[model samples]
Target: MRRLRQLAERTPAGRERYVDLLRALAIVMVVLGHWGITVIGYDRAGRPTGHSALGDLPWAWPLTWVAQVMPVFFLVGGYANAASLTARRSRGGDATGWLIDRSARLVRPTTALLVVLVVGAAVAHLRGADPTEIRTVVWFATIPLWFLVAYLVVVPLTPPMYALHRRFGLVVPLVLVGLVALGDLGRILGPAGLATGNYLFGWLAVHQLGFAWYDARSPTNPPRRRLPTSRRTGAVLLAVGLVVLVLLTVVGPYPVAMLNVPGARLDNAAPPSLALLAVATAQLGLILLLQAPARRWLRRSGPWQAVIAVNSVVLTVFLWHLTAAVLLIGLLDALGVLPTPRVGSAAWWAWRVPWLLALAVVLAALVAVFGPIEARTRRHGDTTARGRRRTALAVAGYAGVVAGLLLNSLTRKAAPEPLGLPTPALLAYLAGAGVLRLLRSGWGSRG
Candidate 1:
């Protein structure tokens, strides 16, 4: 614990290389996981429709364990919140305003991206594609959008959550572990009632653990003085996390790898498991231990500046990358050049390599067109006339979204249901409106 405090104390301010490196790692893993999914086919219900274990690769499950799922993303997010909130406090920013600002950044990009996808889905349906098939594709494509909703919910709670960190620290993770264990025991050993509710709470409990870590590490003063003891504490926490993970897998009913089996009714990932919680703790602990090394390396690298420059665009990429993938696949198919979509075949999986490459090309193209527009839009908080107009526009936009979601729920399908997407679209629209309102106010106040 003392060593841990010393390491953290040595970390320079506004120079969070460890966190940034962890962020890049999380993003790259997420993208790779998504790219892998494109190769694996899905049925009209959005279940995995193919398997790749036939390649006889023994490393398959282990690879999935390392690459798939969203735990790492949430872990890094907690770190960012801690750093950002601490920085904001030093600058005298109000908690409500900070929440509002962060929420706007998250919501608007998602809204812009989802509107494009929904419009595209409508067009595909009109063109006589199987409604169920297209609906399933859209359902599958919207998986990444959940991060926006989850982050918004988690970020605003940071103020209180940070308080929990100060009080409980390591005990926080223990309590979460207990909750997850009880949830798992109920589902796997007993009547299995309310598994869905348990699932939501269970996964969110893991996200809160990240918040706790941030609180422990973040302080208004120099970090070392506040942190109990950095190096020894970090190592012990990491070791404990690993032991818990091994025990859960050995004694529990769940598989360690997160991705669902083809045709499996329930997925470990959709409502993540204790295994994931274990993985997150271990990952977070290790990252904390390596903070000093990461900071030193990042300080020396000029390329990191470029990554930090675009750090704000991570949400934009996650929201729209799937759309870019869909566009690339459709374009190639229309030209009669790309192979047709298939299920349960090695050759089909093989074609995904090139499709992923094309997905990259398409994402770059979208960024080229919309990136500047998004950048300029965020700066709108500087003037009053434009602020008032933008606020009005945002209100109207949110009203439209409410109407659309209600209609979809009544007439089309239940969102957040079996292979559905209600949370992302709804949350995105709300967040976008909030962003517009803020920017308008910022602009008006400046004037």
Candidate 2:
């Protein structure tokens, strides 16, 4: 703790401390929201089943607009990526190098989770666990990887998108918003396939705004710069987004919830409707408005240190949070202490505080065991033939991880099979991690 405080005290003078704070806060909110809404119960056969509390309480949909922090996550990702790309380029680094380095950070920590799940699932299956129960458990654990898959795609595209931002500025996000609207319309009037494009376009648009935010404060581009950090700009964004969101829900085909409801005919989030984009706009606006104050508050040593500690383990917390919830709930159930309150009932609401606390304890333990993997950094091998080959191998490894997660998201099934996990995704991820490890060990020796 003392070391962390000293580290915070040594933070670079001009760093955007607020970006880290926002990212950490977004992760916390996402974890809490997931823990709160996930209602686990037992079937007549005494197997665990889970559903979201929001499905039962439509009135709570409005709350999700605030709780859905994914926009902020991407926005911060854009800001950080722009800064990273700029720094790397100034040092004569190429996009491939930057992509490999950035992707390694995500892929490494993810490999830890995947290994545990794969081995644990195999053991459970061998022990004669119900296949349906195993499937449910594995599916719940891997569901959060969707964000990782999407963000992985967005990260590699940052180089090109940053270039586009440099050329067209705000027009990029505007066009993306237009595309989101078109996708929503296509979903309404045509096949739902058109809306799938928005899954990328919508997030890319939000990410583009991050580039805009970075450009607004660019040290190089003075004449073209526009300060989105200004309060008035934020007010305009908030007002416009809120109005559009209300109209989308009231008059358009979009649902009010920023998340998917189990049986909803139209989900704002599944394909990410313009309504969700509006919510993101409002969130970005609110975050920008709070940026100045947040920066000021973060100037203090204590708060900044907390943010630093959290950011250091952010990925660990995110990847293990759901697993923690599952394990904690399962333990409590086995001990006959877990409550099976009706979803959205008063008793369920009362249970949320304790449930979150217990989940946090479990997550903290998971982090203690696995957090070092996230913090470990290895020196790059020499860039000769051996080095280049290893780098390529590392990149392939990261790609496999992304592909596996994407497949899992699309299939929505990550169960344990007798020989392996349900989908080929886990195999891809494992293969990728293995190649990277082999390169790390053998690349320098070959040189």
Candidate 3:
């Protein structure tokens, strides 16, 4: 028992490597998952005609295991939120302002992107493009934005929901798991059932897991504290999580989609599923087990520091990734450079990989364009020059987004269509970038 306690309470070396590695790893999963859907065309489709051999290969679901790293994102988010709230309270900062700033950090960038997309689609229609085609293009271009809406819904609720964490401890996640099962069962049996409501409770449950991890509060259970030993608890968590995952996959209606396919009946990802909860548990255990090794690795790796440096702009990367793909595709098609989005054959997959790589490069370049705006707003600390400079840049970037949105609207003057990559999108990019920058600077400064 004493040995078990030591293992459980033993602190991983270095500062927050598990969290950072998890975040980076989660983001990588997200990118790869997206790459599969858009570039790889992998996964089973509802219809036989929808199958793509190259994309939906035998290894797809296993790949989804890596791709569904979203649960970890929420876990990290919970940890960060708890840390942020604690830090802010310590400094006597207004809770309202802290939340407002956080909300703005998400909203500002997100709004800009939406405005651009909505406006750009409208313009493409005005230019005499087919309405369905325009809509299809825009929809594909901005699919990942759904996370923004979901995150926002959960972020505001964190203050209150976190209380449940204090009371329930790790049991909160189990309760959430129960809720998902209930929700799924209801949807399966009832007439008016859809899993939409599950989105609120189910995903929030995942997010709350992070809060528990955060609020566990002690670095290591004190040697004198009579809590269950770390080794025993970890082993228990690992065993149970593995068992649950196997059981759920075998018996559950869940489809193991870490990424959305064009036509899926029940998206395990759209609202998430109990399967995801199990995956998260297994992942959390792994993270805990390897904390020491991850820390040592991060310390030794310089490139990792670069990744950490850039993670502040995670939303930026996530939001614009689709646009980058669309832009590359649009340009290639225009120049007779790239083929249409047809899924089949190794040849198609091979060609698409380079295009996806090019898409990533373009996204990086595009993100760089907004780097200045992102930098200004995300600055921390009290300084007149920094504040003034950030405020000015923020305002200008916001204005650019607005201007772009307005221009996109006007560009659609004669005929109406949804906005596309027209002027509105450009404005949205600037606006979103500027707003996130401001918040990053403001929030970071306070910390």
Candidate 4:
């Protein structure tokens, strides 16, 4: 802890603490939101059953607009990636090298989660656990990996996208938003296939805006030509986004909930809608409006150090949070100590405080054990034959991870047996990790 404080104090003068602060807050909100909405219970036969609380509490829909922080996550990702890429370029690094470095940070922590899930599933199957139950558990546990899959795709595209941002400024995101609108329209009137495009377009749009923000505040830019960096600009963003959000939900086909509500006729989030983009716009505005004060507050050692520590294990916390919730709840259930309340009842709401605390404790323990995998820095080999091969191996490694997660998501319930894990996905993930390990070892050659 003391070391983290010292590290924070040494932060570069040009570094924006507020960006890290936003990322930490966004991750916390997501974890808490997932914990709150997930309602797990045991059936009469003591089998576990679960669903999101949002299914029963329709009125809580509006709360999702605030709780859904994916946009902010992507926005911050853009800012951080832009800064990172720029710094790497200044040092004469190529896009491939920059990508390898960034991807390592995400994939390392993710590999730990995937490996654990595979082992746990195999162990449960060996113990004569119901395949159906095992499948459900594994699927639910891996839900958080969806973000990793999306983010991995976006990270590799950052170099080219940042270049586009430089040439066209805010037009990139604007065009992306326009595409999101078209995707939504297609979902309404055309083949359902077009809706899937939003999965990329929506997030890419928000990410592009982050580049805009970075360029707007670039220290080298002349003051006169810089984009308006005032509170007024943020206010305009807030107003326009809010107005569009209301219109989309109230007057258009979109739902007010920013998240995908079970059995909802139109999900604003499954394939992000223009409405979701509007929410993101409003969120970016709100974040900008508070940036000045947030930056000032973050200058203090205590607050900034906390942010640094959280950011250090951000991926670990996200990847393991659901597992922590499941472990805690499953243990309590097995012991007959788990509380089951009606989804929206006062009792259920009251239990949330303790539920969150218990989950946090479990998550913390998981982090303590697994977080170091993410923090451990790998040695970069010289840019020789070995280094190029290492880069190729790294790309294959990330590809395997991305493919495995994507396949897992797509085929989650495709199997007839409950206990069946996606064999192909598991193999791909393991193979990728193995290749990365070999590369890290310099392909069996001495360092």
lDDT of each: 0.58, 0.81, 0.60, 0.82
TM-score of each: 0.74, 0.93, 0.74, 0.93
Tens digits of per-residue lDDT for model 1, 1-447: 353345445656756566566666677667756766554444586333333342333346445656654676776677677677777667665444455455456656656765666666667767765666565556545656555545555665677776676666646556766776676666677656635554445545655655655555556633322433377767986898778877766575666555655554345665566777766666667766887776677665354554453454666667667667666656665675656455445776777678677778888788776565455444212223333454444444444444434333333432322223344545645554655455536532332
Worst 10 residues of 2 by lDDT: 378-387
Give one clash count per candidate, in the order shown.
Answer: 17, 0, 26, 4
The stretch of ten residues in a row with the least summed lDDT in candidate 1 is: 379-388
Give me the overall lDDT of model 2: 0.81
Give the local distance difference test score of model 4. Answer: 0.82
Supply candidate 3's per-residue lDDT for 102: 60
Better of 2 and 3 by lDDT: 2
Candidate 3 lDDT at 64 equals 68
Enumerate residue pairs that collide in model 2. Answer: none
| True-vs-predicted CA distance for residue 80, candidate 1, Å | 2.1
In angstroms, how far off is 32's CA in candidate 2?
A: 0.3
Cα deviation of 117, candidate 2, in Å = 0.6
Candidate 3 residue 346 C-alpha distance from true site, Å:
2.6
